[model samples]
Target: MTQAPDKLVQSPVVPHIVTELPGPKARAHLEFDKLWTSPSVPRAYPVVPVRGEGCTIEDIDGNLFLDFNAGIAVTSTGHCNPKVVAAIQDQAGKLIHYSADFYIPLYAEMCAELSRIAPMKEKCRAFLGNSGTEAVEGAIKLARFATKRQNIVAFLGAFHGRTYGSVSLTASKAKYHAGFGPLLPGIYHAPFGHVADLKWFDEVLFKHLVPADEVAAIIVEPIQGEGGYLVPEDGFLQGLRKICDDNGILLISDEVQAGAGRTGKMWSIQNWDVEPDIIATAKGIASGMPLGAFIARESLMTKWGPGAHGTTYGGNPLACAAAIETIKQLEGGLMANATARGNQLMTGLREIQKKHPGLVKDVRGIGLMIGVEFDSHEHAAAVEWASFQRGVLALEAGMTVVRISPPLVITEAEAATGLRLFGEAVAEVAAKG
Candidate 1:
């Protein structure tokens, strides 16, 4: 019931193309980037962005695009949001960096904010970090430390992060582990999104591989990301909670992608009404700042002694300031906007799906975190490219799903326009197929 700020801007003319994609200037930048950047960087398309505002982006060329990707859902408030910018500017002038070893007022304030908003019933404490991977890694350490257990459980098709520990927990794709070998031991993968799968943890995993008593935690995405924007069937998350409770294991919700108002709630886990022992979040938490955190119950977090884990640049003041303002904006109705616009987009996509039943295999998700699945990866890639050509920026998730996650500030008109452009893209690709 929070009211949106009056400062929210009206929708602007978007998806405007003044030049070809990867135009002259963009091509130059791409060539320069290829020379200096690491080859591992995945460049989705050639739209070289220079700046962005609200739900719109402008490439190095004169072309404008309606950004449905939102920098992979990192920009929750919108690109260059004025309020967040003001907060960052103010904090930068006052203080920029302070190590975790010393007292940082902003860091304490940010943690307090996280505690207030955490989905857990008990009072919580937080450990801040620099990215989603770091958050997950911290959660892993906390789980193992608190439970005195070594084994961990994760889901197939879940992308936690790319760091050593987090990547070890990931099973979304094989290429992520192509060269990296001997991943962290005592980590097990379980089928995601079904009550029946929870039984496998007891019967198959515990009996055959690892014992339930040895498992430290079961880390899961409330709504799977990267693998696909897949929503679990009802009672699935509750089942996970029960399993954790019955086994004396901690329940860790990896909200790195689906948290921060993306799913019309403070955390995606809220949608399931299941309380997690720990929550790892990043991405949209700070409105594009390099900040992440793993929040746990007060009793559990207090058990860790000093110097057990720490970070230098994790709780930077600038990031904290931006995060405070971002949370305010979300509370001030960006979350509601996400719900409204998300419904509009989902409904429109389903209509488009009706036109090409064979091409679009499924349309599913909650709030603004949505996926349009195609019959094959090739068709999904084609539709994604076609959408890009039309100046609507979108990204692919899983092997054959196009993710639609735009800025929460996206207006109804903007979403409708995006849907129309997306529909055209799908039809174009469908005809070609």
Candidate 2:
């Protein structure tokens, strides 16, 4: 039987569906979406969520769902968190934007907060931006300016951003680059999380393609985000650090998805005990507000003079305030909760994988960031669609991996309930097959 834990069942706000799929209101909203929204945005299912609290989402149609996607991992602290909202409100009422070109309290406060929690050993510096892609773009420019190099190495299945510079660094989907001709030059792609890839970087790219000194940085997502949520093999981060040191290349961790307490740490790379020179962050940084930052060691940042990189509204006061509160909330308790809930969810998924070997190829994750890969992309899509019907919200990553990055505030009972519904969805899909 599909059921929630007793505690969760007693809770009034957990995955309660009132209407059928895409009810009248949702259908109307979908039509409006089709007419007004850009076609580029890929939506898996029709769920016009009107409100959200913690890990729960309520569609305009009155269907409640467990929001496992968290708006593509952007709302890490959960939607409309009161603290974050209060911060945003207070900041907005006081000061909205004076352009980040000048000093501001929220900006200063956020910078200090980020530096305090930054993974860098020495004093760190931060350049604020407005999105994950902007952070990555800023990191790219910073790398070049700091190292005086031209070429950069990025992984093959990375989803950096949609901007020209970031998209050039992105090799996740061909569609991202379709007809976007002549992307930023001097960028190279390599296999992620593979030691051979690093060796090739040394033996081939460094030796033959581009000189090591000419390479600015090797950008990577410590845990591949859009790339199947694949965790690197043990020692991968350590090896990466060594490679960067040997080559005088900076190691840039694109932690836009894996950072901000998502991977049971302030930064996912912390699990490796290796420090990256620079880390780009966003997505979950501002609890859904448009905010991002590329933090680096002070020494690296000192190489570049002022005017080398700048943004007008990079550090929007409202976003910065919310981000600061988001950090505080995560540090308070959500980080630990994420670790425990992740264990619960992973255990359940592994059990389900064992039951449906043909459907689930693998189940793996750390913290609340998880992926369940099916035999084929079609099967994975079917399962996700089925889950949506069962009042669960999920997203797909890579070709055949379903990503589950729930809000960090999710309770253990809520996690169990989501997992149970997901298991039932998979069974339903298998039965249909």
Candidate 3:
């Protein structure tokens, strides 16, 4: 096993804030970003990071923080992992950009790796894309083409993506669709994580709305991400698989946030032992590189012709190289580390919940993709801010859940530190409540 750098493995006194949060340099950068960047971007905290290594982030003002969010679970192998960086540098030197229309060796290599690690039993084929939204879009198209169906069913409180097609399938927030009306036709939604609700598809939805035969797919997040990291109850996934099989519908698992070793397993769906016909993945695929893909059963993917779907930068050599190395790192030992550290974090959080029963409602998750539910959004936000003040970065999800997903490479000491800091934050919020 390759050892993590000493600093990442051991930090006696981390979050050593020499200045206040958003100190002078960070404040200046934040002000500049506000002036130039789009207003749509949401700033979780005042962190203005200039550099990151492992699970640690250093702001422009030299304030250090233990990163628990991992850029919303994108940096799986850790920030700027040396091995992934080396792969990217090597590929950049050789060839950076290439048309996906033309065959790229690295593209084939990444697909092969994906197929090897695929959760499904069938031989898999992949379509590369630039982001999670693109992956979902490709899957949507593939499901329709392969099944000759026009309708799709997604679960409520599920976040697929923000693109027109993917966003149409997203039901996590009403605001995501408030203004963008006239969404793609034939898309439907059902309550998530409830096996009983699966009956709604046959009894209510299919009977009154879109017919079962016309349904192309049912897309879902194995563990809801932006909706609050909610793990489904037992039999929920199996129920979906059964429903799809009975209706000849494809099941697409959106693993954008929960896959690539974040849940200890390579794919979060593996936790349920249920295989989906298609898998849309991105966030942690390349350890922060801009890459995503939709891997489907070979029989399904083979239905598409050459001109059916394509992207210019989908399989850029640099991103592919980084993806290969990221997979290597995940396979090496990081996935196991996630299982261990996740257990540590979950246990500590449960203790905290016990101490503040009224404030904290629930603590649930698998591996690193964990969420702590508070009594209200206000409490969740307060805890989020308090954690930031103490130099531990975290994020809020859904209405009243705080998501904790640090890098897979986070060491035991770092996990303990983050737990301690987060516990303190929760305690502070509880006291105020």
| Per-candidate TM-score against the hidden true structure | 0.97, 0.96, 0.97
Error of model 2, residue 144, in angstroms: 0.5
Better of 2 and 3 by lDDT: 3
Pairs in clash, predicted candidate 1:
none
RMSD of 2: 4.2
Q: Give the per-residue lDDT of model 2 (tens digit) for 268-345.
A: 999888899999999998999999999999999888887989889998999999899999988998889889999999
Better of 1 and 2 by lDDT: 1
lDDT of each: 0.92, 0.88, 0.91
Total colliding residue pairs, candidate 1: 0
Residue 346 of model 3, lDDT score? 96
- For candidate 1, the lDDT comes to 0.92
Best by lDDT: 1
